[model samples]
Target: MLAAIVGRPNVGKSTLFNRLTGTRQAIVDDESGVTRDRVYGEAEWEGRTIPLVDTGGYVPRSDDPFERAIREQAETALADADVILFVVDVTTGLTDVDQEIAQVLRTADAPVMVLANKADNQEREWAASEFYQLGLGEVYPVSGTTKRGVDEMMSALVEALPEETDEETPDRTRISLVGKPNAGKSSLVNATLGFDRAIVTETPGTTRDAVHSVVRYEDQELLLIDTAGMRKTSKTEGVEYYASVRSEQTIRDGDVCILVLDATEEIHKQDLSVLTTVNEHKKGMVIAVNKWDLVPKDGGTMDQFTKYLRQYLGTLDHVPLVYTSAVTKQRVYDLLDTALEVAEKRAQRVQTSDLNDVVQAALRKKHPPSMSSGAFVKIKYATQVRTAPPVFVFFANHPEGVRDSYKRYLEGEIREAFGYDGVPLTLVFKEK
Candidate 1:
């Protein structure tokens, strides 16, 4: 179930969103129009995880381009929501903008609940009764900051939502397409799906929200999440900053991420920054050099480009690279296939005997560097502890003495014994 928060400027919609979602995902500030796009989060209430969206302030009619864009985003949220929370300020009473928003909400297909925000005390809570004049049913006086009457409002919200089913498939692979703006992430999605599921334009920040779509390939379901373009925090303003935050959050939630790059442009520092984020999160990743058809290439051009990219990737060299052309649909499906393969590798597990065999072989090939005291650090045994971003734990008498260089050598040996291509490996050294 999806619930959306909507109101005019500075009605504390973002604060309410943060309150409901139990996260500071939405940027809350005293300034009006801080949130200019749709930000998504999941709220856990009454043992259910409900999807919630916080939208920009609703402007009934506006000549300003930003305001118009915000209005469209709010309307889109309303269309997709299962229920709408129309927030109003009890301190200010009803105003012209509130009335205008009410008029718009009245036409929505979903049920609308009026939230009288900022009722921190009993006196202000009494004033919340005035919002009933707006003609929306069930006005609940609550404070997004103080947590007053929030539970009562949530109880009603959960009761009002439709019952959910066990429709979520367990075998589905979620692939998130993330990169900087105008990198053809959306274009690649449209080309792969053969439909315009996402809005495509020359505008750099055209996609502000992470859009999700499901498709079947070879009878296997795949969930494709298209996220907003990530920009440097120093260059982002209020809206773009929050969009970047949402994109990063999407990376953590995805099974595998496809980092799209513009083929015509040389790899930028910002691109490496994104690659590092995926690597640090221990998420499976694939680098897609998009607009491949536009690049002037010879027989060895792709090879040279791959070598250059690997230099930037550094230790993340295991991440697979694919040359794609979204405009021509060149190798788009091949990119998806590669992502699926990476996801499989991410979940691959090694038997304990095989793990120890590889570890023993690695130790025989190269003894670990001696400790500062000139004592040898002995790694007694190793075990495969987890999968899906496979993890291996090594026990030793002096675990802290194991150098990072030695860890890399052990990881290399494990990869040779068992292929974990395009997947991050976590090695944990613990005292026996």
Candidate 2:
């Protein structure tokens, strides 16, 4: 079941959304209208994860383009929602906008629950009674920040849903193409599939949602995800802001992500930040330096550019990068080949005996560092605990004493021994 949190600007709707979904998907700011698109996340009640959408504040009329987009997004979310959480600020009392919104929802088929948010104190709780004049239904006082009255709100909301929703995972290799706006990600998607799956536009933020398609290459079927170009939150407005949120979901859920970068534009700060997010998710990745046709080339230009990229990758420098131009189809097949190789590496697992041998060699070369007290950290065997972004557990007497430098060393040794390249490696130190 889908429930949308709807209200006017600065009424704590985004705060309420975070409380319900237990996700930082929606950005909460003191400034009004920070949330401009319908951001979707799950809310857990009892044992079920209920789907929830955080929408922009609804306005009856607006001349500004962003505000108009917000109103349209809210209306679309309201139309699809099974329940509407009409959040209002108790401290500010009821306003004309609240009444106007209530009037529109009054005729809607979905049930409306007026949430009097920010009722953290007795006086504010009493102020909630003013919303009864809106005539929507019983007013439920809530504190989005404090999380007071949230449980009761969920209890009521669960009973209001039409039925319990269970989403099934589809069987396919999911690949997400992500990058900054106007970086030619959509064009890359078209080149890979040999057809236009997403609209390639000159304007930034043309693709509002993550476009999905099923394609085949070498008899292997995979899900292709072309997502919106992410930008700084401060620069994103209205629909573009929420589009980036959806792209994050695509990265987390995808098995492999091909990060597209424009060669002409060079790498930006936002590109590195997005890569950090992908690495955090521990997904297999390949960097596609797109629009290589635009870069003026010399005998050593490509070599210098590769070094520049490696500097930015830092600890993630192990990830493979391929220079390509979707317009000219330069190295396009190489991108897919490397991406598949990355996915294979993510799923590769080393046997326990091999892991222990590699760990022993690494330890013998450079012993464990001791704590400030000079008590030596014991060296022990290791095991591959899992795969799909392979995780290795290293047993030690003092897990806390193992520094970051040592961990990086172990990761390098494991990669050299097992050939799990182009994927993030997780090393966990624990006392056994």
Candidate 3:
């Protein structure tokens, strides 16, 4: 379920958003109108994942261009939300803007809950009584800064949200197409969808938000997410910054991220930054060098391109790579197949017995690195502790002496034995 955070500017809505989502996705600042776009985040409260949208400040009858844009964006977010979390500043007391917001949400299909923010103390909480004049419903006093009363607020929100059930198939693959702007991510998605689902143009940053499309092609059910081209932090402004954060959120939400790299351009720092996000998220990945039709190719061109990518990707070299052209429709359909392939690998599991056997063989082949202090890492046993970027915990005599090199070697051996290709492995060293 989606909930839109609506209020006048500078009322700590973004602060509340950060508290709820446990992420700094929305740019919080003292300056009013800093958040020019609606930023969506996941808020997990009482085992339920609620999608929260931090909307731009609502200014009624605003003549300013930015304020008008903010209001438009907030309305767009409101249409998608099931609930509206109307925020107000208790310290500043009730104001005309508060009344304007209340009046606007009165006819909304979703219910509005008044949040009297800055109620960090009993005095402020008491001061929030005037908010009753809005007459939407009962006002809940909470501190967005201290997070005081946030649990109660979230609990109230949970009650307001509709109950959810597990309806998604386990095999449904969510593919997030991501990369720098103008890398043809939107074009690729449009081509894959066989229609102009996403707006494609030569202009950078044409896509302002993540466009989601559900398609079933030959038994493969896929959620294709096409997001705006993300520039460097220094280059990003209000809307673009929100887009970048949403891109990261999209990465986390996806099962397998198909990174679309520009074949004509050299691999850039921003491209690597995206790779870092994909790596950090531990999502299964497939790299697609888009616009391959534009690249002059020889027999060894693909090999050289892959070699360069491997040099940069280093440990993540095993991720599947495909040369694709959205315009030519060359290898575009294969993206879904590769994404499903990666998703399958992410769900693959190994038995404790087989994993321990592989561990024993690896340890016998190469002993753990010896520390200069004479302490050596001695493995007692190994187990497959988790899946989804399969984590293996190795209990040892001295976990501190387990060097990174040995961990990589053990991971390689485990991969060789189990064939967990196209999936990142997590190695954990713990003292027995």
Backbone N/Cα/C clashes per model: 0, 0, 0
Best by TM-score: 2
**RMSD in order of candidates:** 5.4, 3.8, 4.0
Model 3: ten consecutive residues of lowest lDDT: 66-75
Q: Looking at model 2, which ten-residue stretch has the lowest summed lDDT?
A: 58-67
Winner of 2 and 3 under TM-score: 2
What tens-digit string does per-residue lDDT give for candidate 3 at 242-274? 677578778878888988999998888888778
Off by over 4 Å in 3: 4-10, 13-44, 51-66, 95-108, 168-171, 193-197, 208-219, 231-246, 369-374, 400-409
Clash pairs, candidate 1, are none
Winner on lDDT between 2 and 3 is 2
How do all models score by TM-score?
Answer: 0.72, 0.84, 0.82
Angstrom error of the Cα, residue 272, model 3: value is 2.5
